[model samples]
Target: MIRWGTSAWLGSLAVGAILAATVTFAGVEDRADAGRALPAPTLSTPPTSSPRPTTTTTTAPPDPCGAVAAGMSSRARLAQLVMVGVDPRGADDAVDQVRAEQIGGIFIGGDAVGLLSGGALGSVHATASLPLTVAVDDEGGRVQRVDQLDGELPSAREMVARYSPDEVRALAHKRGAALRARGVTMDLAPVVDTSDQPGRTVIGDRSFSPDPRVATAYALAFSDGLRAAGVAPVLKHFPGHGNTTGDSHLGSVRSPALDALRGTDLVPYRSLPEFGDVTVMVGHIDVPGLTDGRPASVSPAAYALLRGEFAFAGPVMTDDLGAMRAVTDLYDLPDAVLHALAAGADVALWSSGGRTGEVLTRLENAVASGELPQARVDEALRRVLHAKQVC
Candidate 1:
């Protein structure tokens, strides 16, 4: 606090002048405190000192993900949402494809040792403007892709039978690290479907267990290990494929009612994602009460169940549309791709790599004609960015 005595300012004209100057100085200070600009001097008195320079408030930089998406041509951006399979031997050709199309990702299906062995994937990573999502179906058992290089891993059921959940996690970490070392970014693995069929049945051996809680625990552990290795783990066959009677590869397959799935197959999804982030693969099987004949991979209702009911916010991809008989019976590769995107899939994957140009052309035409909204394409592109961690 400051103090002033009456004797210091009373009974004198000079004292009154000093008091008025002090009042002016304090008023200027108050105006500065209030964020108001100071009044300019009438005579423009600046010869005695240099004036203070003005400053600017800083702003946040624009969104890098949005900037990358906006910088591409319409067809080029659409190309990024489609993941095509590449011949494992034709690594150079695949690199050329990504350079030409601004392709989003590639799947390394059917072991050829060329792409996964001799550091060929380094060139593929460099070819794209964005980082490519190099993926594989390294689900272990007969479904494993790189067994020749990394040695064989047990089936999901076998892992559970022989090892504890933590041990399975350690084994999966070793597997994921091997995949990452080979430049594989995504693993379509650890099937969470609930099944009780014989070990030789289609999804039977691939399933972790018939018990939903057990399946969820093992899936979480496996995914944790994959995440620890910087590879994204994918949960497969949304709405469940374990109890289904047939395979979608041969013909259209159907699952039990939604009510029944809620008690069994759907249990893993509701719990697994709560533990960690994983991309969900919607299967080709049609649901009796939900899909109306369309496979879940192409059904809006099924996606709604995944996106809304189950509340899964991670990336959602469609199972292979190129070879699946369920979809081939109705539409060609291009149409199947379109329906999956329009139905809310983030990525449209086709293990059959040809026809990329044909499908892309159709997609461009769809955007021009409004059959597929540009907003929908943008939304999916954002999800693709999320999956690749580009955003």
Candidate 2:
């Protein structure tokens, strides 16, 4: 476990802030728990498809973890790793939780407009020491949440059908700007799954194409737009959830063999480096060939693949752990949060259930008892602070 003296923390914070500001001022422009059963292998090994060329100007800010570490208590820092959903009716309660528990972020869903309007979100923001990462699922089509407040945008599939890559980027810029105007700083979008199968339901309209190259093109374009608009974009369902017929929200889902995944499921992620510090959301689907029946969200092997093979260095987040039956049916919310963090996810997203105070308490106890390592917590906290700094 890692420990730091108060003086060391303070010094590091000062240095971190200076480095962060220097990097920014320089204007450097860069351009589910367990699987019930193993699924049958479907596709044969296909030819490799290279990602389409795209440019991005953003780079990660200098590490700000020390600044957060020096300023907050352990409980407060741990809270930064959890993202909870809020109800419009209980907006006041949510604000209280933010101040009392030092909750890291808030997600608006279902009637988001009602919950966030009239300075409701601003009221919550007023309670935090650091800027909270206010996020929404604004992927367009059926997955949009806040668009109900403004107007509708086309789905990923529809955008592909009607617009060029440049057009899609323009639309995403407008959407991202609109979300930012409402105090939202992050967008969970640009579904990168490459599912072209005729009957695929979970990701049918959300994905850009069945072709990996096309998906790569649109993913980068959408991310660029979001970054330009000042809202961070998150690439969803990592390791690919488009090929599966099962919905993780309902039950367990499985992927094909490891070799087959390279050509299809892994393409969009391979192209992630081009997008700078964009976040990646790991799904609940199990890949038996890779993880040996453990859900990707809770399996160290899956995260190792992402960090070791793909070289993803940004914040790694989990899909809604409380809402999905794959996890809820197996482990309690707190236990699931521990598993996800231990497996390398930096953010444990609770879109439906789980109280922020209770989650923070459990995480604290786990760390105290060595069930979770302090180093792990520190690393996750660093990534979380890094994300906030960039936003």
Whole-model lDDT per candidate: 0.82, 0.78
* Model 2, span 44-95: residue lDDT tens: 8442334544544555565455654877788887888988887755467668
Give me the overall lDDT of model 2. Answer: 0.78
Quick one: best TM-score, which candidate?
Answer: 1
Q: Compute each candidate's TM-score over C-alphas.
A: 0.84, 0.82
Regions of model 1 farther than 4 Å from truth = 1-62
Q: What would the per-residue lDDT of candidate 1 be over residues 1-391, giving only the tens digit for each residue?
A: 0001011222221111111111111112333347655557567665334445444444455565676677789998899888899989857868977987978878888768799987888888877766678889988887898899999999999888998899988988999889888888788987999998998887988999999998998888888888777778889989789999788888888899888999889999888546566789999987888888789999999999998888887778889999889888889999999999999898899998878899999999999999999999988887776555555
Candidate 2 C-alpha error for residue 57, in Å? 37
Alpha-carbon shift of residue 88 in model 2 (angstroms): 3.3
